[model samples]
Target: MIISRESGFRHDTKRRGQSMPKRHPVNQTHNALEDEDSCAVYTALLADQGSTRSELRTKARLPLPVFTAAMEQLHRLGLVERDPSADERLLALPPATAMIRTCGDDLRYLAEKQERVYRVTASLSPYSRVYREMPSSGGITASGKRLLNRAEVGETLRDLTAGARGEILTSLPTGESEELFTLTENALRRGVRLRALYRSSVQFNQSSARDTQRLIRLGAEVRLVEDGFTEIVVIDRSAAVLPLRDDAEGALVVQDPHVVHFIVNAYSRAWAEGSAFPVRYRRQQVLEASDRTKHVIMKLLAEGAEVPTIAKRLAISPRTCQRHISEIMNRLGARNRFHAGYLVGQRGLVD
Candidate 1:
């Protein structure tokens, strides 16, 4: 039996009638300069620099086929050269020199590839501009407003937030989704200033409280308001998104500079009237926890909100809400609920 070292193969040399050890096929596929066969041949040649090809195969202990393949690959890599003075002898180049030559070739190839990429992109620039200027099927209106269905709002908001370089102002009455929470986190990481406004009653929602706290920790400014406010998102004061209908079935994306500026002004006014959200954290907390529920109740009462409505908004029982209302009425020395609310505003309590 003949055994090949690097290839890990055993060749049986027995006749048909004789019992012999297991035989395996020889490996002939690998011929790269880095393979074990090439490495063995190179090392042998290094030890005896001016050796002939036949002497290298004998010293390397590699089969003739493997030795020939390894030598061809080494020559291609400039690691082996013909010794002109010696008849059939081979000369081994310094490994460092060969590596530098190979790397220079690879770098030149990569530079050419990168240049081709730039040229291809430049050729397509005009088509990209044309695509952006073309109108969508039914999403864009004549007024330059794009209509987005409920399913498209999240995608559009993601794109807008990703591209936003300046401040992002948002007023959402129904609270934000977890997907939006993640998207906003990414925006905040990019150093974009964010100011979000939500209904004061959202403080009672455990989910919203957790998400809002995380956002605050990431340098977002949040506020709570009790009075009327519209749901909108103003990005960079250049674009605005609003509900297309009262039911929130769709959205209207406005990019008209004048319309966007108007929305921005309205948002600014509402934001000024809002109260800072009480973040439960260390020194980074925005506001100290106060009787915010009572304050909100006062505002709702002034707005003529009923007992059940106030209770639902505050996430409390109606009986508990009535008790608070009674306390307020007694403290004001008022005759009726409406009269108590009148005194609350008359005394400038909600301010």
Candidate 2:
């Protein structure tokens, strides 16, 4: 069963007497029979879409007949497309759009499946004269569960994002997904406030930079934190999705109000400290904060404060404080740490 933060929508796609329903196109392409060249072609195109027929055949390593068969099947399945307007026949499809559509289809299917399961389970239980009920946590409603695979986690995120109205908050760990970019872009267009935090390291990658720029242009408040963050998605402060465990392939979806509130608060604090990464505002916050720290450190150093004490005041390391002191001395053209202080007083840089 599923719990939607929007309207308490409970849905299930699992069937007790049968295997799980086949995935929609987004996932089915990955599970196609390996012996069929269709799977190979699909995977090749997935890695690099808009490949010419020749390029695709070379990448998939399939004979002409096999390649033709694969492309035909993929096109039929809606996982690939060949534009009639373009004669060159460079096949293409936006995988992110396909994923969003598949997610929507599966969600609707699951919602119906959930109702059917409850009917079946309740009917079987009523065979006993007295209504034997499952033990429950009663009014607590602190329910939580693990999404066992990437597909489940992705579906849940799609649902929460689709339903999000007030806001969507995210901490990106690996990088931005085109799928996520599409979702957030649509969300912003729909008038939902969006904010995201990522590691400072991502600002260097060309592709990541483009994606970040696109998100910011679409009205997302994007920022970068240095450390102590994890992947999290909070929707309208009503639900949260996070990894089930560290480096796990699973996710935990929480609807508990208190837990979601705490997670949102943590995100706010991190956002406040994050450095802006745009070309016009690259790392302004970190530099400004460093200047504030340096200002205090200079005053302390001029009073003959030891490295360890200055470090304590600035919440930095003794070695780091010593390095700062060294830089200060260099700036003042002083002979040593003691001389740096004398120069500071003479220059009237500090009171």
Candidate 3:
């Protein structure tokens, strides 16, 4: 006979003529194996087949209290059972049988819970219908807001971008999405001014970089921020859509004028601070710092600043500073940093 517990209910599966069902060993470890003392008790009982609790405890060399606890654990795990014939005698189930019984119990419990959930859901479905059909004042809902699922969010974004007239401001994370690229492209084609912020990490992703390059080529202004804010889209400074929560696949669309204005202002600040996307220069084009960066580097070099000092002053890496120094030397036909500084001073580049 085998015993199992499902949702605190016991089930008995009896077999004909209990010849101590063939003990089939299982190579896989069970949760019951985690307890050393319980494992010791189970091992001893498995070897001896049928032994009184006290006899097995003595054979296992465990104290009474410890053995009792181990036996309790074994019982809970369905590995050991009290003999129906004798009060103190016990029987050890085959490892495979115990595993099967335990798994069946868990499956039964889950089935019961799933049935209950289905019942509850069915009972509330009418209420869900009523809520969906509930009337609104002036056909208006809660503060010009809509909660949209993943698919709906994409469709709604496409609609918003297609209808946009003035401008679109968007913040993107570290991955590329075909939906975003398509919508952004459509908006730009309508002569809608679009400023997009992408996480700096996105530049490292080949596909996302390609998407960004396509957008830039289509006249969409793109910038990279150290940490991109949550994925958002603001259309014509009148509406904003963002994720409802980090873990949720739904989005929240907000159209309240005040709220939209706040989101647009916040986006403006981030855009102002974000760095322009790096230009992919052609082979013949020279790589040099921007005019402002070049002017600062020139001033620093004239001050006899080291590479590290120049880098810190310009918020760049020493390697980049050194590269700029080399470019400046080549540009001025100079041989070294000292000569570069002399050329800059003579050309009044810093002034």
- Backbone clashes counted, model 2: 0
Please name the candidate that would achieve the greatest lDDT relative to the true structure. 1
lDDT of 1 by residue, 1-351 (tens): 878898879855464554432322324465454488888999999999999998999999988887888887787667898899987999889878876665665556557667978999999999777654564654576455555456678778888899999999888864567777788889999999999988776665678888888899999999887643778888898888888764466677888999898888888899898887766545423232225567778888888889998876765669867887887788889888899889898999986
In TM-score terms, candidate 2 sits at 0.41
lDDT of all predictions: 0.78, 0.72, 0.74
lDDT over C-alpha atoms for residue 28 of model 2: 43
Candidate 2 or 1, higher lDDT: 1
Per-residue lDDT of model 2, residues 181-257, tens digit only: 88888899999998888765466557887888887887888886645267888999998888765547777788889
* Poorly placed runs, candidate 3 (over 4 Å): 1-144, 281-351
Quote the positional error of residue 19 for candidate 2 in Å: 51
Clashes per candidate (backbone, < 3 Å): 0, 0, 0
Better of 1 and 3 by lDDT: 1
Full-model lDDT, candidate 3: 0.74
Stretches of candidate 2 exceeding 4 Å from the true structure: 1-143, 281-351
